[model samples]
Target: MDDKIILAEESLKRNGFQVKIFNNSEEAKKSLLESITTDESVAFGGSMTLSQLEIYDDFKNRGNEIYWHWKGEDRKKELAEAYKSKVYITSTNALTLDGKLVNMDGVANRVSSMFYGHERVYIIVGKNKISKDYDDARERIKNIAAPKNAKRLNINTPCKFTGKCNDCDSPDRICNVEVIIHRNPTGANINIYLIDEDLGY
Candidate 1:
């Protein structure tokens, strides 16, 4: 196993989180499905892994209500409702070898929901999304993740043209809100499934 990945798993384990490392996405899916079945009221935040797994459909099919922030949706209403809702699925932009969850969002839904709303949270990560350190993780989002997301969503942010974070104040700035998950809540629960293959952006 890669030393960094090993470190990440160890750090998360020490924090009282259940860490599962899989060889690929298929294994991740199987494990994830089993985990979800054991829990009640599964909810999902925005995530490329969920999109790759098409896991939201699975949750909905199984009668689990997912809470998430959508692009171009009414932010005020979504934020209000999410405050009290429990979230089960969410994606972190980058995970450092030391098990730091780093992400940037326009509305901060993804980060806040992970830390607060959910009674039990499950974060799915791809090895490609792992970084050497916190600074590298954040930089990856600012340069690679943000620009690619902007292009994919056709956002009109300055970084779309510059191919790097320009710290734009545009309404389309997806990196406006940033959050780091350093530790799981004392009494709350969080689990991380690390997939060896690339899963999401």
Candidate 2:
């Protein structure tokens, strides 16, 4: 493992989060499959990392009850179902080496699900998401992740065109809510899987 991965793993574990470091997405996916049972109910936030791993398809193929608003027919119903799921899987926008998880959300569901209504929360992140510290993590989200996401989603935000956050007040601004997870939420078992590969925005 790289020094950054080691530091992140140690810090996250010390901060009360279960941490796993994988050399690649395939190894991470294998471990993920082994961690959850076939009957477990799984939910997902909008995560390009999860999509890259095709985790949803794997879970669905295994007959696990999975809810993802992005893939569901009824967004409202799926969102409600996801809230009630046993496991919630998502990705963070930035992960600090000091054990902080940072994310910016538009609807707030992804951030909300991380802290409540789930027995276990699995956060999948790529090496590209790691930062030197909390402030660096925030900057990574604001200057890199958020801007790229806005352009990808075709949102009319200044960051989309400028490739940087202007702290815009646009209604379509995706960086509406900023969340920092310093420790595992009360009553939730948070597991973080750090993949060596760059898999998400």
| Top candidate by lDDT | 2
Tens digit per residue, CA lDDT, model 2, 1-201: 667888999999989999999999999999989999999999999988888889899999989999999899999999989999999999999899999998889999999998888999999999999899988988888899888888878989999999888998999989888889998877889999998889898
Off by over 4 Å in 2: none
The weakest ten consecutive residues by lDDT in model 1 span 64-73
Give the C-alpha miss distance for residue 109 in model 1, angstroms.
0.9
The 0-to-1 C-alpha lDDT of every candidate, in the order given, reads 0.77, 0.91
- Candidate 2 has a TM-score of 0.97
Candidate 1 segments whose C-alpha is farther than 4 A from its true place: 68-87
On residues 45-80, what C-alpha lDDT tens digit does candidate 1 reach at each position?
A: 767778887776676667764445552267566556
